[model samples]
Target: MANIKKGDLVQVISGPTQARGGDRGKQGKVIEVLKAEDRVVVEGVNFVTKHVRVGQTQRGTKTGGIETHEAPIHVSNVQLVDPKSKKPTRVGFREDKVTKDGVTKTVRVRYAKKSGEDL
Candidate 1:
């Protein structure tokens, strides 16, 4: 598996209008992961539009708007943003040596290179 997983915080690293200084380093949380295409849908990020059937569909949640957000960005294009400093950071995966279980299991852990702190 890739180093990225759902519920992880990430940053807009490379993309149109995001490659430059403005939104390049803007932080967001990883909401979904499309592993087949190596894509990730960040929360409140990479917004797009979609048509919704008003009141015709109910998924046990509130319903609104005919056009909705729909955008799935490439996983490689985004970098994991550090939660503490709120800056873009690199993520690395290794066996969790200090896990409660005696068995070995790999975990997608991150460490801020600039701050030198484990995320």
Candidate 2:
């Protein structure tokens, strides 16, 4: 399982975005996780602009113009933010006993290594 998932808030640790200076320590939510490519699209991060043909349109909607959106960043470039500390921390899995409908079993749960709390 991926330590980072969709909707998880993350801090940029290192990457192209970090190299730019301003976004080095910025934190944003994960918009999409590309597991196969081991990359994630964080909200408001790694923005890229695409220019379209002026006369392009799909159906009744305009499809031509400059569009900006978040681009995928390597997973290693981000670190999960600890909910308790509000600081970036590493993620680790732990076994926990969970009971559902009276059936109890051990399940692996992701936790913040710094705070030892379930994520």
Candidate 3:
């Protein structure tokens, strides 16, 4: 199972600090997970520019221009944020017993190692 998933908050842990104009300490929600590439796209991080050819939509609306969006960063470059402390931390999995409709089942759950909080 992946340590990070869509909608989970994460922090950049492998880039230069903000003082150096890098995304080292920025935190954002996971927008996508490219499992095949082992990378993730985080909101508000790794911004990149894309230039599109000027064109018109079928409805005659102008389209295409310089646009900025988050780029995929290597999965190892980020760590899951601890919900309790709001800090980057390693992830660990443990079996949790959950009861639904009076039926108990054990499921593996990911949690922050630092704060021992669910991710």
Candidate 4:
């Protein structure tokens, strides 16, 4: 299982500090997870500009130009935020027991190691 998932809050644990105009310590929700590349695109982080060829849509609407958007960052550079503490922390998994309709089942749950709270 991945430590970080789409829609999970995360903070950039690496990179230069804000004073240096870097994304270190910035917190944002995970917009997408690039599992194949081991990178994640966090909302409002790692902004990059892309230039594209100008074109027109089938409806005659102009499209393509310089656009800014969040770029994928290495997964190791981010850590999951602890809900209770509201701080970045390591994630851990534990077995959870659930009983429904007299059927007991074990499930793995993600939790914040720092606050010992389930995420």
> What Cα-based lDDT does every candidate model obtain?
0.69, 0.86, 0.93, 0.94
Please say which candidate is ahead in TM-score: 1 or 3: 3
Report the lDDT tens digits of candidate 4 across residue range 1-119. Answer: 88999999999989999999999999999999999999999999999999999999999999999999999999999999988898888889999999999999999999888744534
How well is each residue in 1-119 modelled by candidate 1, as lDDT tens digits?
56778888887767656544244565777878998888988877766677665564455665657675637888877887666777767765545555556776556555545534543
Candidate 3, 60-89: lDDT as tens digits:
999999999999999999999988899888
> Clashes in model 1: which pairs?
50-68
Clashing pairs in 2: none
Per-residue accuracy of model 2 over 10-110 as CA lDDT, tens digit each: 99877555555546688999999999999999998888999978674556665678989889999998999998888899989999999999999999999
Per-model TM-score on C-alpha atoms: 0.65, 0.83, 0.90, 0.92
Error of 3 at 24 (Å): 0.4
TM-score of 2: 0.83
Candidate achieving the largest lDDT:
4
Predict model 4's lDDT versus the native.
Answer: 0.94
Compared with the true structure, model 4 gives a TM-score of: 0.92
Give all candidate RMSDs, comma-separated.
5.1, 3.6, 2.9, 2.8
> Ranking by TM-score, best first?
4, 3, 2, 1
Least well predicted 10-residue stretch by lDDT in candidate 3:
110-119
How big is the RMSD of model 2? 3.6
| Candidate 3 residue 108 C-alpha distance from true site, Å | 0.6
Model 4 residue 73 lDDT? 100
